[model samples]
Target: MIEMFGLEALSNSAQAATTVGIVFTEAIALYIGYGAVTQIVHQATREFLGGE
Candidate 1:
């Protein structure tokens, strides 16, 4: 999969870099999406959780 991106198909350096980049991107996007959802439902979420 990583090799198909015209990148070096190596087990040592390139593969590790690609894997790291993919995981980092995914984690960042997930956090951003959660933040947006939380902001959108800030009031309702507080009420549902018995908060102020």
Candidate 2:
């Protein structure tokens, strides 16, 4: 896709760095998203069970 964007001059190291950065960012996003969903489910379950 980067090459398709006319960035054929982009170096291999730059591409590797960009890939790593993107993976890291996506991992963080998924972690945060799942954490939020888990918190919501936990709260609902607790309420249903008559806990605080």
Candidate 3:
């Protein structure tokens, strides 16, 4: 199944490490993306809601 994804055949430990690294990268990107989105939306809403 994994080979279908075009990754080289890796040992179990290597696969585990790669999975962990990918998961961590995804988490950081998601958090940063959402945090910036929320901050922008919050400021825009505050101004619009406050009529300022």
Candidate whose TM-score is highest? 3
lDDT value, candidate 1, whole model: 0.84
Deviation (Å) of 34 in candidate 1: 0.4
Model 1 TM: 0.60
- The whole-model lDDT of each prediction reads 0.84, 0.84, 0.82
Candidate 2's displacement at residue 12, Å, is 0.9
Instruction: Quote the positional error of residue 10 for candidate 1 in Å.
Output: 3.4
The predicted structure with the larger TM-score, 1 or 2, is 2
| C-alpha RMSD in Å of predicted model 1 compared with the true structure | 3.3
User: Which residue runs of candidate 1 sit more than 4 Å off their true CA positions?
Assistant: 1-8, 46-52
Candidate 2 local Cα displacement, residue 2, angstroms: 5.5
Per residue, candidate 1 scores C-alpha lDDT tens digits across 1-52 of: 5767656756668788887998899999999999998887997889899998
Each prediction's TM-score versus the true structure: 0.60, 0.79, 0.82
Over the stretch 1-52, how does candidate 3's per-residue lDDT look in tens digits? 3465555588888877777787798899999999999999999999989955
Model 3, TM vs. native = 0.82
* Sort order, TM-score high to low: 3, 2, 1
How close to the true structure is residue 35 of candidate 3, measured as C-alpha lDDT?
100
